[model samples]
Target: MERIAIAVFITGASGLIAQVVLLRELLTIFQGNELSVGIILSNWLILEAVGSYIGGKGVEKIRKRVEFFYSFSLFFSLSLVAGIYAVRLGRLLLKSLPGEGVGIGGMLLLSFLV
Candidate 1:
């Protein structure tokens, strides 16, 4: 009970922190445009909802609940690190010069992919 509550709180806090960190990285990649902020946020929300729906359905099938939870938490943390790296790498892959803004198509593609 209390342990679960604390775990939930930590998970939520870490998630929010990850979002902010990702947003900052994305803004740097996209040259800090206002539209980039909206696009990043929209994509984040949509993906989160979809992931929640899929995970919710799949979670019931797992027998080792505690192990699964811990494993998933670690995976989530690693994913955030990878996501940030991908966003930074995207700038180079897209061939955009430093401080140059990414176009809408590039932004959308990178945001969705990351």
Candidate 2:
């Protein structure tokens, strides 16, 4: 569960950073302004709220039924795998030095893998 939460936060932060840069460019691309930026962020927050609520409700049922021992063991394994792969891929991509497409794909894929 901690793995899932960390994955969610890491991926969300990565995406949010990219979104910030992309959104800044829209004023030039579409002749938009700060008002458009505000709207976009508002929309993002609104969707995030809906997603968080739905996820919480969905997980509540599973949380009640699944034994903590099994569930946590599984989550621990997944976190181990995710942490190892993320480190390996991150190092590999870094050595490549600003090349290849290993960027967000690796992180995003780890979320799915776990």
Candidate 3:
């Protein structure tokens, strides 16, 4: 009921915010390269599908655990914030890695983390 509706709203809003953050971070990391954007978006879609499938498989087991859902949502929101910070600081942190910026593999890994 109302709880479920609130959960749904929070989930949707957080997901949208995360998407925007992820894209902006990728663009910054990749220097606005169209190819990089495509790669990140494609990988994002595939990974999201995989995640949804995995979550679906576990839904029944957690059906009675509303608290679990709430906790997971909270953790997810926190992770989004942390992930954004990590990506923002990536260049400085990885500055000694010897590159103008992170490579494709690094970018993919960062995108996956986000």
Candidate 4:
């Protein structure tokens, strides 16, 4: 297979897996509430938009560093897996109080990190 095809497959697989893990984690954290789902989706789109904007502005500069991009992408995928584990453990460690859920600031931070 071509290198580009391999890269695309890896990227797609990582993204889909992360999305499933994140959605499951968020649903658990938010007690499976529908509004929480919306919040997660909105946060995802917002962050994605920001990434797109930044990538658009720096595409030329980024193209010059393909090796760096590949390295970073590898690290990112590894981190996502670790992050999923951490989130699962964190949910157990940091149990939500009655009538409490993830706040806006926490959601924003989670969205930014994830």
| Clash pairs for candidate 1 | none
* TM per candidate: 0.93, 0.39, 0.79, 0.73
Q: Tell how far residue 74 is off in model 3, in angstroms.
A: 0.7
Identify the candidate with maximal lDDT: 1
**Model 3 Cα lDDT, one tens digit per residue, 12-114:** 9988989898789768877778777887898889998998999889888875578887798888889888988988877665562433766777777667766
Q: Residue 57 lDDT in model 2? A: 84
- Residue pairs with colliding backbones in model 2 are none
Query: Cα lDDT of all candidates, in order?
Result: 0.90, 0.50, 0.79, 0.73
Off by over 4 Å in 2: 1-9, 61-114
- Give lDDT: candidate 2, residue 31: 35
Of candidates 4 and 1, the better by TM-score: 1
Q: Alpha-carbon error at 100 in model 1, in Å?
A: 1.6
RMSD of each: 1.1, 11.6, 2.6, 3.2
Using TM-score as the measure, what is the rank order of every candidate, best first?
1, 3, 4, 2
On TM-score, the candidate that comes out on top is 1
Q: What tens digits encode model 4's per-residue C-alpha lDDT throughout 1-114?
A: 597788878888978888988889867766777776777788888888998999789877765566876887888888888877766665444555645786666655554555
Identify the runs in model 1 with alpha carbons over 4 angstroms from their true place: none
**Residue range 5-110, candidate 2, lDDT tens digits:** 7765765675566455544433232235455445556655767798789967877667454365456556655655564455445435434343333334443332
Off by over 4 Å in 4: 63-65, 89-95, 98-113
